[model samples]
Each structure stands twice: as structure tokens, then as C-alpha cells.
Target: MSNHTALSTQLQHTGIIDAAKAQQLQTAASPWWLQILLGIAAWIASVLIIGSFLGPLLALADNNPVRTVAAVALLAAAIWLTTRKQEFLQQMAVAIALAGQGLLVYVIYDVSGSNDETARYACAVIAILLLLSPLNQLHQRASLSIALLCLLSLVSSAPLLAVVSSLLAIVAALLWCSRLKWAGFAQAATIKSLLEVITLAALALTLFGQCLLWLDTGYWLDNRLDMARALYSALGSVLLISTVFWLSRLATVPSRLALLTIAVVLCILLYPASGLLVSTALMLACFYGCSRNWYALCLLSMLLAISQFYYSLELNLLHKSGILALSGVTLLAAWLLLQRYQRRLV
Candidate 1:
């Protein structure tokens, strides 16, 4: 802590940071709970402000095209407001933008004759645009990406969506794990935010896939979905292999092969349990990536995976218990192997 303070002081002395900026940096920010409360208060204020004018706006518009135009204008204004330096304006901008998005979706639905598919596609495009543009802040990007994945699930078949999401997770995990390699680049901050958004979306889609399987959704297990399920599982295995190889990139060939071998073994053991395989890969990604902020998410994913294993319909309780025991033993062995390698290096 003293080192950090000294460094900051030196940086300020060197004129790398202005005095005001340095002071701002040195000051402790509000607690997380207080920040949340402030944000909620800001949102409530924005909502009430919007609501007060919304009725009159609707009365004046009264038609889909006019409402769509109004919604677009509102979104544009909200985006512009976000670029302002004031914290309150930024908070209000997020709420206003969300409200604009809801209004836009409603208008789209009405314009397209209540076509759900069209609305989903439109919203997905908007989400992708927001993710790609600098107009959105970090939290907005994360929320928009999650919304994008949800839109995808609505438009595509469950099995195919599962495969797409697994592949997305792998790519996102690799990007996140390699973040330090390109940290010196000018685009690093943008890339970091983008990867964070993608990582969140991947986690969300993984959980969505798990829920479908856990609920035994009729659409997920229909006769026509057999081939799709097979494809999903096959692609999932490949993705798991790729994730393991990437996470072990710094290791020797023998070590990489050993990790891959363990991953493949787990893949085979967890074949009937699709979500657990992907969740494990994601958890490994978080762990090896040293993503401290995402540690809670990784823990949650693992807990859900374990619960999914316990409730899997493919295996009876005795078989599930045995497989889980074996899984625990396998993980322990892997941990020991890794420790041995670490000790050798030390």
C-alpha cells in the first residue's frame, strides 16, 4: 500500500497525472453497497422523470412510426448524455437508454405485426451495435451482451444455440486469458471491456443451456433434436479440448498433453451431462486467467454444475454419486500433479 502511494506521488510529481486527478485517485471511493444504493436512487429518479413525460409523449405520437422515431431520438440523446462528465447524468443516461430500448422493442413488435422473431432479431442487432460502439459504458455493454444471447436463444434452436454459446465461451475465455499479452497496446482498454462483456454473455448462455437440460424441456429433447444434441455435444468436446490447450499454453508439451488428457477424460465421463462440461471449462478459464472479479461467478458455475450432475435424468442416484466421487478424485489428482510441477520449478 505504501509502495502504491509512493508510486502515485511520483507519477503526480512527474506531471503524468494532474494534482486534482491524483487527489481524486488517492481518495477512497464509496463502498460497493453505497454505490449500488446511489445507482438505484438515480434510476428511480430517472424512471419517474421519464414516466411523467411518457404519457404525454404517447398521447402525441399515438402511432408506431412516430413512437419508433421518438424512441430512436431518446436513445441518441441518452448515448450523448453518457459522454458527459457528470456522474448523475451518466446514471440517468443508463436508465433512459434502457427505457428507450424497451420502447424501441415495443414499437418494433407493433410495426412487425407482433412478430416475435422480427423483434428478437432487431433487438439482437441493437445489442451487437451497442457492444461494438463506444457509446455504451462497461455495465451497459455487459447487460447488452447478455440480452444478445437471450435474443439468440429465442431465434435459434436450443441445441444449436448451445453449441454456438460453448464456442463463444471458448473464444472469450482465450481472449481473457491472454489479455496481459497485449496490455501495452493502445486498444487494450477497449479490448478488455469487450472481452469482459463476451465472458459475461458466455456465462449467461452456459447457464441458460443448463436450465434447458435441467428442466427437461420438450423442445430440447424432441425426436428432431437428436442430431442437434449430438452435434452440440461433439462441438462441446472440441471446445473443451481447445480451452484446455490454450489455458496450458505456457506449459511444456508433456504438461499440456497431460492436462488435455484429463480434460478429454472428463469430457467422456460428463458426456451425458452437457452443461457441466462447458461450465468446467469456463471455471478453468477463470481460474487460470486469474480473473479475481469473476471468482464468485466461477464458484457459482461450479456449484450449479455439481447440482446439475446430481439431478441428471440420464443416470440414477447411485450412478451419479459414483461419477461425482470419481470426478472429485480426478480433480484432486490433477491438483497434486500441478503442485508437483510447481515444486520442481521452485
Candidate 2:
């Protein structure tokens, strides 16, 4: 057969050049400008409807109806936009969901009897939104979950709301685990999903710690140091486990560096003071492992050092003799490690 005939046959076998269906799919997908206009129209309609109808009705019931109505309206508009523009839905959904979350936080602050209650409800809403929105459909699951969690937290007593929020968190965790199991870690999408899950979990834990602090300042002070240490340890363990799994699947140097960067950041955030030592050591090790690449380690190390320095200054340790001695030793060790790696690379 001629080259042209052979190429045509191969294209048909691979299903890349479908002359009939490609044109139809392209036509069916809405243009970018049209999608934008539709989203704007939906947002306007939601605002008007909620402001004119829902706001007044809620106000009559002695609620801060204006803010509530606005939050609901924005959330509705986001759902509508997601439905009409599924192609670009992920990016748009995050923005709209965040706006909705902001509105909810404002409403919680304005309506709550105490700042502690407001904070608890705000954290709960944020955790639920982060857990639900990215994995499931915006309209079906995320909107429903947000609405339910908001009502439970804002309208219920503190004790009951805390229970409800904790339950919801457990549910979200289970669902996240199931998704991870089904979509194996080898997939790129799975990596993104796992990162989101870890972020939400970390935020939830921090908020839980804040709640403990708010309930009893004395108790918080007595236990916070230990709690911080434990939290950082847990975070470190998670990073080590995830790194092993990721390294097996990822062979490329850049991908490994990316994973290491994420692990380093998590360590810093989870335990800024103590994490400084670990993160510094990890970065140096990463640099050595990656063949003494200065460019790769520079940014990660600088971020960890800055955060550690800020935390140290905050704790009034800058003038302490012991801290200064420790800092000097740490720097010397890091420099030595760098030199050793540099020589090996040469």
C-alpha cells in the first residue's frame, strides 16, 4: 500500500482522526465568550432573586437576612455556572466557592453571640467546602454539603454544632480515602486529589487546635506546646510515607523535586520552630540526592529559614545564648553538607 493509505489506516486504528464526530463535539462545546456571558447573567439573576425575595423573608424571621441571602445567591450562581460550563468548571468553581465561603464567614461573624462560636463555624464551613467541592459535582454534592454544614454550625448550639461538624469531617475523610484507593497513586489526577485532601486535613487540625485554645486559654497554654510537637510529628510521618509512594511511581528528577518541595512546605507549616531543623536537613539531603543542584534547594531552604527566623523572633529567642549557638551549629552543618555534595558532583 502507498504511504498515504497506510497512514490513514493507522489513524483509524488509533481513533485520533474521526472525521464525523470531531466536528460535532467541537460545535457542541460552547465558546469561551458565550460561557462567560451566561455565567454573568446567572450571577445577576441570583443576586436579584435572593435580595428581593429571600432577604426580606429571612429578615422578617429576625435573622441577618441580607448577608445570608447574598451568600446563598452567590453560591447558587456558582452552581449554575458550573453546570453550563463544565469544561472550565474546576477553575471557576474554586473561585466561586471561595466567595461563597467568605460570605458565610462574614455572616457567622456578624450573627454569632461570641467570637469563639463564629470561629468554630467558619472553620467547619471551610473544611467542608474544601473536602467536598473538588471531588464531587459542584451542584449536586458541594452546594448541598455547604448548605447543610452552614445551617448545622450557625443555627445549632456550640456543643451540638461541634459534634455535627466532627461527624461531617469523618465522612469527608472516608470518601477521600475511597477515592484514593479507587484512583491509584500512579495517576496524576490522584496526586492532585491527595494534595488537596492533605491540605484540608491540615487546616481542619489547626482549626481544631484553635477551638481548644478558645475554650480555655489556660488549658491551651498548658498543652499547646505538646500538641504542636505531636502535630508536627504526625505531619512528618505522613510526608515520609507519601514520598516513598510517590518516588516509586515518579522516576523523573523534576517530579521528585516537586514532591520533595511539597513535603518540605508541609513540614514547615506543621511545625515552624522545630520543623526548621528537619526541613533544613531535608533540603540539604534533597540537594545532595539530586546531585547538588543549588537552584532547586535555594528556594525551599530560604522559605524554611525565613519562617523559622520569624517564629524564633516572635518567641523572644533571638537574644538567647542557646538559640544563637544552635543556629550557628545548624548553619555550619548545612554548609558542610553542601560542600561535600558539591565535591562529589565535581
Candidate 3:
């Protein structure tokens, strides 16, 4: 949402589309179960096999000199091997990097509490490693995902700092995507890759973390975990406003009266979905898609957002129906108004 206005206003001023051309999509891959099998194996090893087991086995020693040195050396070796290989060992590189990050995290958790007593400082160091990933392969993307996971892991413990850093990272990603001029080396792949990681992290947290409980329960709201949801919603509301203005007024009457009417209807959406982290994620994804002219993303985001609303346990059927009706009508009116504006311009 921070970057949405900049791009949207630019698009309106210039009759150009820095967008992907339309083409039918197709996919071909090996058995889905096999792919899942490999992924599960890799993830388990990263989180348990080498990550937890070997990390603790080494930490049993009284000192970290050997363990730290070995971790660094292994990471260096993995990067070297990954870059040197002619064949893309994407899985191998990703697994090794994950293992390294987990080991560093473990060291920070175990030793930092006793020494400097600043575990967060070690977390920051690990974050830097993920950001400065040495492998010039797809492993870089995996590093971004791990980095996002690290951020999410810190959210409940350090709500303000983690949310601020995640916001800054998303802003940086948008700026990078904007710089990828047509036919650039990586095009928008880097931007998309970065966003994908962030999106998945947000989804995971909202779906499985304290976010669900926060949304589904209102008995207690004084915890730090709830702080994360509030912060996210506050930021996401900016995009919601921007989008409402763009669709209903900017391209229409552009008058105070028109703006007032639109805001009144948009209020319906605010109360029902504002506090939920998943709702924020959906809207942010929608705004991101609209800003970047990613049609497929927009459609997918819309469906996900709708489904989330339909499946919400926080609101009863009657309230859900009201919210859905209001949302649907608001969008319908905005769409009709936008179509009219387009016709007038034509």
C-alpha cells in the first residue's frame, strides 16, 4: 500500500502498461507426491535431522568455538559447491543454507542468553546472513523465505520492531521491482520472488500463529501477539483507503460529495475485516497486484480474500452475510463507476 499510490498515479498519468502480456498458462511437472516427498525430506532435515539433532549434538560441548567455525565453514562450502555446479542443485543448496541458519539460531538462543544476554542481536546477525546469501542461484530466493520466517518468528516477542522491519522489507522489494525496466536481466522475477516469500510467511503466521486466536477471540486483547495484528491492520487500512478512492472517486466525480459517499460505503468493509491478520494479508496482496498490473495475482487474491471471509469463525452467519453483501455491493459500485469513467475517457 505504501507504494501503491505512486504506481497507480503514474499509470493514470501515462497511458502505458508496464505489465506482463497476456498468455495462456501451462504447467508440467513430475508426480506431485514425489515433489512433496522431496520437499518434506528437505524441510524435516532443515528443522530436525541436521538442524536440531546435529546442532544440539555439537552444542553439548562446553564451548562454541568448534561449532561456530564448523557452521561457518559448511555454509561457505555449500555456497561454493552450489555456484560451481553446472547442474542446478537448488534443493541441496537450500537445504544446506537452512541448516546453517538453524545452527546459528540455535547458538544465539543457547549462548547469547548467558553471555551478552542479547539474543535478538544474534537473531539480527542471522537475518543479515540470509539477506547476504552468497549463492547466486535459486537458493537466494530460499534465503529470502527463511529471512521472512525469521521476521515472523520475532513478531510476537518484538512486535513493534518486527512489524517495522517487515514493512521496510516490503517497501524495499516494491522499489526494486519498480527499477526492473522491461527485459531486464531478471525482469520482475526478483520482486515476485521476494513478495512470494513475504506472502507465504504472512499466510503461515496468520493461519497457524496467535493471529487466528486473536481474531477468533475477543476476551483478551492486551498481549503483544495482538499488537502484531493491530499494526498490520493499521498499515493495510491505508491501502484499503487508497483503493477505494482510486476506484470510486479519482476516476469518477473527483468531488467532495463523491468522496463522502464512497467512504460511507467503504466503512462497511473496515469494521468486519480490519482486525484480522489474514484479511490484511488478502487486501495487501490485492493492492500489490493492482499496483503492479498483475492480473492473475489480483484474481487469485480476490478469491482468497473472499474465501477467507466465508470461512471466518469470528463472525456468525448473519454478520458474515452483512459483511459479504456490503463488500460485494461496494465493489460492484466501484466497478460500474470505473467502467463509466473509462467509457467517458474513450
Candidate 4:
């Protein structure tokens, strides 16, 4: 506190900043609870405002054309509001955008006769549009991304889910890996925000895929689920191998080979529980790209992966235990060898 005051005083004395600006800078921020309360109030107000006109419009909601037009109008309003300089307007915009998106999706589902595939495609299109739209608010983008994930998961086929999960994984890998290269670009912050959203969606999708194992639908469904799991495992292994290969480019030739060997071994051992591979690859990518403040996220992902891997049904308890134990031992040995190699290099 004293240092900050001294620095402020120095800046003020040096005429770098005026007294009013320095005083403003030194003002304390709002309390967390106050901020939360404000957000809740804004949401309630927005909801009520939307409800005011929606009551009469409810009759026309059944008409696909009317609902579509209304949704587009609301989305357009949201986009405009988001560009305003007011915080309250931005908060309201999120609510309006969500309502608009929900209505649009409802229309899609209604038009498709409740077909999951059609709804999923509609969600993909909406998500893409949201990404391209001028709505760069993190909260808005994250909410829509989550909504897309949830809607896609609802009644979606296992094969479709697996494919979406793979695509998200690939996108996350590419974004995180190349984040630093684009750091100086005008849209770097936007890219980073998108990366965060994609990473979260990827993690959630991986969870959904892993949890599908416990769903005991009919025999035919079981066969389809097995195929999806196998497909994910193949893709995840390739992704993990590619990630390790990318990371190894900075190492010596022998170290690169060692790292690739370790990655391949991990993929083979954890092949049955492919969620582990996906989560591990994501964690490593996050740590490599943005380790400064992402340690907690990486740790959370690893913990989730470990817990999921433990309960996974692809292997029996004894087999799973053996694989885990062997993996730990192998990793320990590799770390020790790497330490020795580093000493030799030094």
C-alpha cells in the first residue's frame, strides 16, 4: 500500500498524471457481493422488460416466421446495445441475446419436428454466427458457447458427439499453440477469449463423452456407444501424440525422441479411458501456452481426468489400477532421466 501510494505521489509530482486522475486511480473497486447484486438486478430487470412485450407475442410464438423475425430483431438490438459505453446496457444485452438465441433454437427444433441432428446443426450455425458477430463480450460469448454445448449434448447421437468433441479438441490445440504468435495482433485479446471458451467447451464435451459409458441404453445403442468411444480414443491418441511432437521441437534430438516415446506410451496405456488422453493433452497445451495464470485450470482439468479415468468402465478395476501404477512409475523414471540429462547439458 505504501509503495503504491509513493508511486502515485511520484507520478503526481512529476506531472505524469493530474491529481484528479491519480485520486481516481487510487479509489477502491466495488465489493464482489455488490457487483454480484448489481448483475442480478440487471438480469431481473432485463427479464421483466422482455416479458412485458413477450406476453402478447406469445400467441405468435407458435408461428415460425414471427418467432424468427422477433429473434433476429432482439439479436440485432443486443448487438447494438453491446456497442454502447454503458455497463448496464451491456448486461442487458446479454439477457436479450440469450432470450433471442433460445427462441431461435426453439423455432429450429419446432421446424425440425424435434430432430436432434437438425437442432445440433442449428446450434453450430448460431455459435458460428455469434463468433463472427460484433458481440465481443466474454460473458456473452461464453454463455452462448455453453448453451451450444448443452443443446448439442441433449439427445445427440454418440457418433455426432464424438465428432464434435474431436473438432473442438483440434481447434483448442491450434488456438492455444499459436496464441503467442498472434499476441501482438489487433484481435489478440479476442483470439485469447475464444481460446478460453473453446478450451472450456472441449473439456465439457470430453466429460460428456466419458459419461456416456455409464448410459445403459439398449444393445444396439451399446454397440454404437462402443464405436464412438473407440473413435474418440483413436482421435485423442493422435492429438496427444501430435501435441507432444509439437512440444518436443524445442528439445534436443534425443530429448525429442524421449518425449515422443513417453507420449506414445501414455496414449497406449490410457487408450481405454480416452478422456484421460484428451484432458491431459488440453492441460499440457494450456500450460505450455499460458502457464502464467492458467495453473489452476490445468490442475482442475488433471484432477477431473484422473477421477474420470478411475471410474471408466473400459477396463476392470484391477487392470485400471495396474495401468495407473505402471504409468506413474514410468513417468517418475522419465523425470529422473530428464534431470540427469539436464545436468549433463549444464
Pull out the clashing pairs in model 1: none
- State which candidate has the highest lDDT: 4
The residue pairs found clashing in candidate 3 are none
- Local accuracy of candidate 4 as per-residue lDDT tens digits, 1-346: 7667778878999997889868866766668887678778878988998888566787756588988888898888888988885557777888888888888988999999998677777866785667667775655466557556656546336777788888888898887788778876766766777777777777777766776777664532335787888878889899899998997798888788888888899889888767778878887787788755564675676677778778767678898899999899879878987888788899
What's the residue-level lDDT of 169 in candidate 3? 33
lDDT (tens digit, per residue) of candidate 3 on 1-346: 3355556546645744343321111122447787667666655654554555456657676456656665676576567656653333445566766566666666666776654324555655664565555564366666666555454445444356335544643453344333434224543555556655555444443333323443643342235655654555555455445444443434345443454465555544644343332333344444534444433443454455556656768778888887778767875786687566678778
Better candidate by lDDT, 2 or 3: 3
For candidate 1, lDDT tens digit of each residue in 45-79?
Answer: 88898887677888876898777777787788788
Q: How would you order the candidates by TM-score, starting with the best?
A: 1, 4, 3, 2
Q: Please write out the lDDT profile of model 2 over residues 76-112, one tens digit for every residue.
A: 6555655553545543554555566666676777667
1 versus 3: better lDDT goes to: 1
User: lDDT order of candidates, best first?
Assistant: 4, 1, 3, 2
Identify the candidate with maximal TM-score: 1
Which has the higher TM-score value, candidate number 1 or candidate number 4? 1
Q: In model 4, where do residues sit more than 4 Å from their true spots?
A: 1-34, 56-69, 107-120, 139-147, 150-160, 217-222, 291-295, 312-314
Worst 10 residues of 2 by lDDT: 205-214
Worst 10 residues of 4 by lDDT: 214-223
